[model samples]
Target: MTCTTAVLLPGTGSDEVFVRAAFAGPLREAGIALTAPAPPPDGTALIEGYLAAFEATAAGVDGKLLVGGVSLGAHLAVEWALRHPERCSGLLLALPAWNGVPDGAPASVAARISADMVERDGLADALRIATDGVAPWLAAELNRAWPRHAAGLAAGLRAAGAHPAPTLDALAQLRVPVGIAACTDDPVHPVAVANAWAAALPRAHVRETTLAALGEDRAALGRAAIEAWQQASASQGSD
Candidate 1:
């Protein structure tokens, strides 16, 4: 339950800078040293790339690690923890976008749609269309990440869409505590996904967040995850 070291990964197209801003504050408060590494670039083996990244990071750590991430990164976090339960002390799954499998998952669907657009009209058009109606911060992030890795990110989404994600049966058997956070107003990462995860995991907690608040303070996402983990740990202890 004492998580001194942790590794965090960013979502598709995200770099280390984005993940650090999202995780630094809360992890520091918890006295947990965090290393947010950028996942491998878009490749044929997108999932495997992330899985390997998790393995490599945990291998370098001296003690049990708290692993967590956002969206696709979150998916990889749970998948890795399930495989090497001994290495994972806790999980902070923020904005879980897929459940059971990636087939027809909303997040993957959106990613694929974006990919198709980029492939058809090119990155500039895709970025302009995406950031048009969104908030400045959200638009800025989309502009920053999407253009940087448009092609690879699109390919990564296709691979992720074909992934057979963790099922409820698998989640029920998770050995480490879990904290699932979600933005209620976010369509891509639905709140229902987080709720389902919390209900299925034997020791999972949910922290409902809002898109507006998340836009205002990116660290709020990390705060929600850390607080939910603490709550889940407390409830398990009381039992």
Candidate 2:
């Protein structure tokens, strides 16, 4: 039997540990083989690095491929899937950060990072503060793996900074089935943005869950996302 495969990409300042904690266990229970690739600690070239890693891992595969990510990763997944709709069997996007204000309109981690860079001794401290507040499960992983994770953060920051917010016009054209799982009150990924993406994608299905339901708890979120994918895949097969 050919194994169904998926690539789970994490958000900015997040690494494999974080993504694994959020996806691995639950997806395994659901019988999906997902690989969470590690991100460089510095996050400087995260998007390109992640895309390259994904391509490398998927080499020689000829079965259905699912690609998904959280926040900035989600945006990248959507962008890549749009470019290769024939390759992507489905998409799972959670908490897209693409709809937020630009680099200087507050809520802009990009602006904060840039401003902090101006200080000789403040950037490191700021980066610590910015990345430390992740979920405890993730914090434990980050503590165990700092340097490697830091490189990913640097690359992710660069990716997020350079990525432009996706428009409905662009998303509406994608034919690949999509599943959007959103947090109700996440400022970084507002409910409105998720709703918009769901509405825009031609074959998009949406599910709304809370942070409390997902925090440090991968089972709830992963199961929900997987079930959505199963349903979408089933529906697509039926039609």
RMSD of 1: 1.8
Give me the overall lDDT of model 1: 0.81
Global CA lDDT of candidate 2, please? 0.65
Q: What is the per-residue lDDT of model 2 for residues 11-62, given as tens digits with 9 covering 90 to 100? A: 6655677667777886777677887787744456666787776676667578
Clashes of 1: 0
Clashes of each: 0, 23
Candidate 1 lDDT, 174-229, residue by residue in tens: 85778878998898888988998888899989998887987899998888988898
The residue pairs in collision within model 1 are none
Candidate 1 lDDT for residue 205: 95
Question: Over 4 Å off in model 1, which ranges?
Answer: none
TM-score (C-alpha, index-matched) for candidate 1: 0.94
Candidate that scores best on TM-score: 1
